[model samples]
Target: MSGVVFLILLLLGLPLAFTLIASGMVYFAQNPELPTAVAVQRMVAASQSFPLLAVPFFILAGHVMNCSGITKRLIHVSNLLVAWISGGLAHVTIVLSALMGGVSGSAIADAAMQARILGEPMQASGLSKGFSAATITVSALITACIPPSIGLILYGYMGNVSIGKLFLAGLIPGLLLTLVLMLVVYLQARKKGFAPTQANPPSFKQILEAINQSKWALLFPVLLIVTIRFGIFTPSEAGAFAVLYACVVGRFAYRELTLSDITTSLSESVSDIGMIMLIILASGVVGYAIAYEQLPVSLTLAVTQVTEQPQLILLMALAILLVVGVVMEGTITVLLLTPILVPLMQSVGVDPVHFGILMLIMVTLGGTTPPVGIAMYAVCNILRCSTTDYVKAAVPLFIAVLALVVVLALYPPLVLFIPELLF
Candidate 1:
């Protein structure tokens, strides 16, 4: 009953947060034995989580770093490294996304930032608007897999997996995504006669100079992982450190951040934080309802009645996620599905950390597809490209990313290697 309500509300265009809350409330109403106050209590209890603190702090940190001179320096470094490649600006867009992933952690934020900064330039440099928008939107998936990824943090929290391990786990997959996407850009650039941003590769000295300028930005993610791995701070506290790091880099080191910029960043952070937290809070009710209904148990039984091979089970789950991801917001999907899916994976002898990383990528990738893909709408809007055209231009890049997902899915060791090595 609640599931039906959720779908109807979601399709009716109710905001996602409200859809979860309302659906959960309907579930309680239908039961009649459970008190409605449980819903309110559940909502309040959700905010009491300490680990969840990472979400807001990281979000604030991303906004602050964007306003600070960090983004500009990173952009310069990306340009120096990749501007000589075929489809140079496109490569820069992909590289900048990988770099921004370490700093921003939010795919939508990275996509929006790159679209604003690089969108027009790509088109002006003779790249099609559709391709430029697709590149900007899809490359942002790197942010979801990189260390300090907000998706990983939430997955860890909900599934009771190790945040530090998840952070470590994301490293290889993120880099692989970057490499594959760059290859796609190179091939597409050649076919389209897209010119390189530079006639020749950057000199060694020039590359060193650019890296020197962006050293602080580059050091942030490395320091974050080391601190977490060594028990210097929990992932939640690391979010605080990230904010401090961004502020110091922006205000003191680069001297580009201003009081006004901070005020604006805070304002934007509040909006993002509020939306995310509300969905989380509402999800508590939905989560409680699902558990009370023993959805996970029922799902496990239903799934196990089939072949029950761990790999086959994972593939089925991934297929469902890809479909739901198309119509749902990634965050909402994570909150709603994590509880249901994690235990199911564990039952079949799958590593939770491995499943979590794959889950994050799949859900995050949904935001780049059609229908309700928030990141897709954001980038297309910024670049003024139609969805149809964007999808057409993005097919090859999409296949490249999906191919990486398939590899990671079949070989769990690829996803788990760094986390196992460090932990």
Candidate 2:
């Protein structure tokens, strides 16, 4: 009954956090035998987590970096390295996103940022509005997999997996996605006769200068992982360090950060943090109700009855996520589903960290897709491209991503290798 209400409320366009809270209240209303206080208790308990501190700090750091002129430097670096490629600006979009992954950590944020900065240039260079918007939006998927990813942090918090391990796990997959998207851009650009942005390759000196200028930005993720892996800081503390690091880099190294920037970053962080944490808290009620009902146990039993194969079971879960993702926002989906699916995958002998990467990617990818794709709307709106045109241009890029997803799904080591080696 609560599930049906959730779906109905969601389809009616109620805010996700409110929908979750209301549905949770309904669940309690439906079961008067249970104490009503449980719902409030669950909501409060959700906010008491220590590790959940990572979300706000990282979000603050991302906003700080964006304001500090870090994004501009990375964009400059990306253009230096990739602007001579056949698809020039398209490749720049992919590389910039790969670089932004460490800085932004949110796919929608990355997509909007890129669309604002790169979209006009791509179209002016003769790329269609649809293709440009599609490229910018799809490239943001790299942000979903990279270190400091908020989705991974939430998955780690909810599933009780190591946040550091999940961060490491995302590194290889993020790079792989970058390469795959670049290839797609190259082929598509060639077919469309899209010329290079630069006639000549960057000189060795230019490459060195570019990297030197952005070295601090590039080093952040590496430092984040090392500190966490070697016990220098907990993930929460690493987040604090991230904020400090961004401030110092922006204010001193780049000399682009200002007092006003810090104030703006704080303001933006508060809103982003509030929205995400509220959804998480609301999910606590739903989570408690699900647990009280032993939903994981029942679902695991039901799934295992159909097939014991871990890969096949994972495929089934992915399919379901794909469908759900089209309608729900990614963060909401992650919060609502992680508690249920993590245990189900664990029962089938799937590594939670491995599954986490796949799950985050699929859910985040959902935002680039259909009727309720926030990222899609964000990018398309910025580029002034229609949804129909964007979808048509995004098909090949989507195929590339789906193929990579299948490969990662079949081969667990690809996702787990980095974390295992470091830890």
For model 2, what is the alpha-carbon lDDT of residue 375?
91
What TM-score does prediction 2 earn? 0.98
TM per candidate:
0.98, 0.98
Where does model 2 exceed 4 Å of error? Answer: 102-105
Model 1: what TM-score?
A: 0.98
State the lDDT of candidate 1 residue by residue for 1-423, as single tens digits: 888998898889999999989889998999889999999999999889899999999999988988998888888999989989998889898887777663444577788889999999899888998989998998988888887888888888888999999999988998999999999999999998999989999899998988988999999888999999999999999999999999989999999999999999999999988998999999999999888989899999999999789999998998899888888867788888999999999999999999998988888888899878889999999888999999998999989988899899999999999889878
Predicted candidate 1, C-alpha RMSD: 1.2
Clashing pairs in 1: none
Task: Please report, as a residue range, the 10-residue window in candidate 2 with the lowest summed lDDT.
Answer: 97-106
Model 2 whole-model lDDT (C-alpha atoms): 0.89
lDDT to native, each model: 0.89, 0.89
